[model samples]
Target: MTPAVPRPASRPRLLVVSPNRSHLALLARRLGAEGYAIVTAADGATALGELRRSPIDLVLAELVMEPMSGPELTRAIREQLAFAEVPVMLIASRAEADPAVRAFEAGAEDVILKPFHFEVLVARIERRRAAAERVASMRADMKAMDARAAMKAIELGELKDRMYQLEAERRRVSA
Candidate 1:
């Protein structure tokens, strides 16, 4: 009998990355109230480590920060295979068009303008969560396909061996 395949991990926790202590704290508080497990990081390096240590569902990052800008952080996250599939949202000031565009180019799922209303932020967060779930579903489907393919390959190898044995028997009998 074949063993059952283990299911994927649970819903991912959210990570808020920004160097600004007040901004990160505020964002965490607001999102945390919305029933999300919020994690905070002060820089791109810390963010990368935090993501590696834990499963992150989504990332909301500021466009401008010390050491690494929002786009830089996004690049860092994308470099890791585990996070390459994760959805990212960039927080940028309204006046920064170039940075916003660059954020999207750098692999942000969405660009959220700064000074946004709490409700607006909440709605955006919900939207991001939905997007992330869809991506996760796609990944799961791909994995299932891979497992099936492996099983098929094994079956084919077994069939080849059986055919070889049958041919050998026919030759001996006919000889």
Candidate 2:
């Protein structure tokens, strides 16, 4: 067996789904070598099952597969709130525009054509990962901001109540 690639704890976990066994193996090996933890699924159903089983940072699926095409799988994933934010990249066996367009419409983050250079594929994956990280960071910042705003609103309300009480007390004392 080949030695496992040394990966950092923060490395993204990738789910690779393909009906073709060879294709799946190739992607798993190549991507694993690039320091990504890979989980393989032979079809869309298995892929969905894998998603439910564990957290996956990204999904790489073949464009065409039985039971569910890449676009169909993407739609299914998007329908689930937990998996909706996971970026999906589809691999097309041919340079057809229709399938690629469908993949995009279904919410895939990227679509790579077959015969692509390995370097390009890796680069695309890195780009997607980076984009996802940025989005997550922004979401965290928004949540924190919202929390602060809520606290401020509560504090303002308390201050207003105190002022009202003070005004009532002063009027009584004057009278």
Per-prediction tally of clashes: 0, 0
Q: 1-175, model 1: which lDDT tens digit per residue?
A: 1222232345337899888899889888867656677989998888888898988888888988889988988988888887897888888898886877899889988888877877776677678878778877898999999999999999999999999999999999999
Off by over 4 Å in 1: 1-12
| Candidate 2 residue lDDT tens string, 1-175 | 3444466787789999998899899999988888898999999999999999999999999988998989999999999999999999999968566877899999999999988988888889989988998999999999999999999999999999999999999999999
lDDT scores in order: 0.83, 0.92
Pull out the clashing pairs in model 2: none
Instruction: State the local distance difference test value for candidate 2.
Output: 0.92
Looking at model 2, report the run of 10 residues with the lowest lDDT sum.
Answer: 1-10
- Window of ten residues with lowest summed lDDT in model 1: 1-10
Models 1 onward score TM values of 0.82, 0.93
Model 1 residue 121 CA deviation in Å: 2.5
The candidate that wins on TM-score is 2
Candidate 1: give the clashing pairs. Answer: none
